[model samples]
Target: MRVVSLVPSLTEAVALTRPEVLVGATDWCTHPAGLDVARVGGSKYPDLARVLALRPDLVLLNEEENRRADADALLAAGVPVRVTFPRTVPEALTELADLAGALGATAEPDWLVAARRAWAALPEPGALRRAVVPVWRRPWVVLGSRTFAGDVLRRLGVANLYAEDAERYPRPDLAELRARRPELVVLPDEPYRFTADDGPESFPGVPCALVSGRHLTWYGPSLAEAPALLAAQLAQPG
Candidate 1:
């Protein structure tokens, strides 16, 4: 079965299914090393004609990455598209199982059990303080409540100040953050890397920590590695 992955995690999923099943991937779909193939531009803004030309039997997408119109057009053209939104660890495992079933591969990884154990075993925090996490740098978007990233922070006993009013990632006015007065702010190295020292000056009076976006944001197998990293941060007294 020829498969095309437009989502980054699905690209990693395709890699887990073994290289032979993957026929095409978007430019951002690099994960499992050494499995280079075709690149289709940005996952959300893919060239529809070029994608159709690939003649893939199946294409993968994420609600966050792929636009609805594009998915609709592809479906209209009779190209099957599998959409996924992996929020919690269980959801992520489910998505992986669905992809494996789609690929007709039986071997699977049980990541949830390990994740729960690690989650439950989180070290007692030296201090529980509120923090704001910025995922993007330019407009200064943050990881608010009801999202995977927000939930993860909650698990760590860190309160999310914007949980009540903001969206998953909302660009609030500078006054809002100042009013909230978070104990320490966290900026991730992701779509835009915010170094610990570089942009903290923009939002003064709040001590900040530059964090690994993949660990804090990426909601799949990556979560297994997140706790260890977070533990180090929690160890530091506020």
Candidate 2:
């Protein structure tokens, strides 16, 4: 079956599992290095015409990454669209299994199996360290409650300072974040591209760790390596 994926992580998952099935993907889907699929557009603003032109049997979308308008348009055009919302590691695993099933593919890929095992083997966070994780820098948007990234960090013994906030992604003032007096600040390099030089200096007294956004945010094969990778980054002297 031909598939078009708007979510980068899901694009990678489908491409790596069965490349032939993916006929089109968003411009942001940059994994599997040499993917030769038709580029639709960005996750937020997908080119509906281009996507439909691919004549895909299924279009994949993420509830967080994709816009509702695009999904509605596709549905109106008689295009089948599958939207997934996985806010935790287990949820991600289940989503992958379900997606694979929909594509007539095996869910027991090596990476999928390893990811499940890795997350399952993790010990509970005994004493959590309070941390403020920034996903964007300019407006200062942070990972808030009920987010996949927050759940990931919580599993690694780091509690998000704004996890109890009302908004899932809150744009708090720098002064407010500092007032929280978090033990560490976790920075991811996507949606904002926070670097060691750019992000760390903002928090003078607080320690900071620059992490891969893919591992921290993406829910795909990356999960296999994320647990250990994030742990190592969080352990760094920052």
Candidate 3:
């Protein structure tokens, strides 16, 4: 069946499923490398006209990266769209499994079993850590509660200082970080490009680590790598 993936993660899944079947994709769907498809556009503003011309049987989407009006337009045109939004890595694996099952695809990744086993072996943080998984530098968007980063950190025993805050990605003053004093700050490499060194300069003595944006923040095929990646981060000798 011909498929069009507007979301980067779902587009990656289509590539994982069968490259030949992916008739259309966005520019950022570059996971497998050499994913050759007409670059319709980015996730936020897909080339709706180009996508409609693809004559696809199914269009893949993600609630996080897609706009409500755009999806409504596709639905109005009588195209079947499947949406997936994973809060954690395991959920992403499940979504992949479900997508594969629906598409009659073979060779499902062993993420479901491995992810749980790896997560179970993870040690917990007994107290709060003043880490900021911020997405941007100027405006400062953080990895707040209800997101994959927050959930994974919570499971591993670390807590977000802004967990009690109202906004998910609130802009906080430097005083907040100083007040909470995170043991080891974690920053995502993408969106904000915040590195471990950036942490030391901003919040001195707070041993920090630049986290893989996809593993911690992305909720797609990348989820399969979360448990082990997180474990390695946690296992680092202080």
Candidate 4:
């Protein structure tokens, strides 16, 4: 089956499992480097005409990574679209398993199996440390409540300072964020690249954990090593 994926993580999963099935993907789908598929623009605003032109049997998307208007447009054009939203590691694994089934896998793929084992092997945290996770700057947006990234950090023993906030992603002023007095600031390099030089300077007193956005946000094969990799980063001294 020909597939066009707008979600980067899903694109990686599908590409690694069944590369021939992917005929198109968003330019942001950077995994499996040297992927030679039609670029469908960005995940948020893909080129619908180019996507449609691919004549894919299935268009894969994530509710968080893609816009509803694009999904609706595809549906209106009589194209089949599979939308997924996995808010936690287990949910993400389940989504991948389901996708594997859709891809005609008789059993869970190696990466999926390893991911399940890796996450399951993580020991429960003794105490949860309070942290403020910034995904974007300028306007300053953070992981609030019910986010996949927040759940990932929770599993790693870090509690988001704004996890109780109503908004999934909240725009809080720098002063307000600083007033929270978090134990640490977890910075992932995506949506906005938070480098050691770029992000750590903002929080003078707080230690910052610069992490890989792919591990923190994406829900595909990265799940296998994310727990260990993120743990190492979170363990770094101030």
Candidate 5:
């Protein structure tokens, strides 16, 4: 079954599990390093004609990473499209299982098994640290209420300061974020790559943790390593 994947993480998940099924993927799908598939385009603005030209049996999309119009167009053109919206660790695991099943592939990949175990083995929740996690820098958009990243941090004993905000991803006033007085400021490298030299300086008094965006954001094989990787980064003194 030929597949076209718009979500980078999902592309990696499918490619790692069944490489032959993936005939096309977004340019952002950079995992499995020498992936020799047709590059459709970016996740948000894929080349519809290029994807249709691939004549894939299935097209994978993420609710957050892709646009609805693209999915609609694919469906209208009679290309089967599967859209996944995993908001938490369990949901992500379930999504992978469903995706694998759809592709006639086994969901019991070693990395997937390890990821489930890693998340399950997370230490019992302890004292929570209030943190403001910024995904972008210019105009400063942060992880807000009901987001996958927020849930990931919550599992690690960090409470997102904007978890109850009206918007899932909100661009909050820097002064407002500072006023919240977060115990920690977590920074990720994707969407808008935040770095030690760039992000830390914004929060002068708060402890900042530089984290791998793939671990914090991507919901694939990386899940197995994220728990320990994030814990170590969060443990470091900012």
Candidate 6:
């Protein structure tokens, strides 16, 4: 089955699981190294014409990463679209398992099995560290309630300060962010590249953990190593 993936995580999952089935993917699908599929632009603003030209039997998207208008347009053009929205690690595994079933896999993919096992092995946290997770700067958008990233942090014993906010991605001013008094600032290197010099300076007294966005945010094969990898980064002295 020919597939076009607009979500990077789903693209990696599909590409790694069944590479030949993916005929097109967004430019942001940067995993598995040297993926040579047709680029359909970015996730939020994919080139619909290019996507249509691919003539894929199926198209993969995420409720958060993709626009509804794009999915509608694809459906309007008689293209089948599979949109996934996984808010927690278990949900992510379920989503991948569902996708695996769609790909005609009689058994769970090895990566999926490994991911399940890896996450299951994460030891319960002794104490939680309150943190502010900024996904973007300028306007300062942060991880809020009901986000996959927020849940990922929760699993790692880092509670998001804005997780109770109404918006999934809340745009709060810098002063307000600092006022929250997060014990740590968890910075991921995607959506915005928060380097050691870039993000840590903002939270003067607080420890800052520079992490891989793919491991922290993406819900694919990377899930297998996320627990240990993120733990090590979070363990750093900032």
The list of candidate 3 runs beyond 4 A from truth reads 110-117, 120-130, 196-199, 234-238
Compose the digit string of candidate 1's lDDT tens values, residues 138-206: 566777657766767776777778777546778976667777788878766776787755668867766
Per-residue lDDT for 120 in model 1?
Answer: 65
User: 1-238, model 5: which lDDT tens digit per residue?
Assistant: 9999999898889888888889999988888789999999999999999999999999999898889999999999999999998889899999887777788875477778899999999987799999999998679899999899999999999999999999999998899989999999999888788887888998998899989899999998889899999999888847
Please give the range of 10 consecutive residues that has the lowest summed lDDT in model 6: 100-109
Candidates' C-alpha lDDT: 0.73, 0.91, 0.72, 0.92, 0.90, 0.91
Give candidate 6 misplaced runs (Cα > 4 Å).
none
Q: Write model 4 residue lDDT over 1-238, tens digit each, in one string.
A: 8999999999999998888899999988899889999998999999999999999889999898899999999999999999999988889999999999998878888999999999999999889999999999998999999999999999999999999999999999999989999999999999899998898898998889889899999999889889999999899935
Return the candidate ranking by lDDT, descending: 4, 2, 6, 5, 1, 3
lDDT tens digits, residues 104-201, model 3?
A: 76667454445556666766656655566557766556666567678877776567777777876778666765676677677766756776555447
Please give each candidate's TM-score: 0.85, 0.98, 0.85, 0.98, 0.98, 0.97
Candidate 1 ranges with C-alpha deviation above 4 Å: 110-128, 233-238
Q: Against the hidden true structure, what lDDT does model 2 obtain? A: 0.91
CA error at residue 120 for candidate 2, angstroms = 1.0
**RMSD per prediction, one decimal?**
2.8, 0.9, 2.7, 0.9, 0.9, 1.0
On residues 147-212, what C-alpha lDDT tens digit does candidate 2 reach at each position? 999999999999999999999999998999999999999999897898878989999988898898
Better of 2 and 3 by TM-score: 2
Model 1 residue pairs with clashes: none
Screening candidate 2 with a backbone cut-off below 3 angstroms (N, C-alpha, C), the clashing residue pairs are none
Steric overlap count per candidate: 0, 0, 2, 0, 0, 0
lDDT per residue for candidate 6 within 1-238, as digits (tens), equals 8999998898889887888898998888888799998998999999999999999999998998889999999999999999999999999999999998898777888899999998899888778999999999987999999999889889889999999998999999999999999998999999899998898888898889999888999999899888889889988947
Q: Lowest summed-lDDT stretch of 10 residues in model 4? A: 229-238
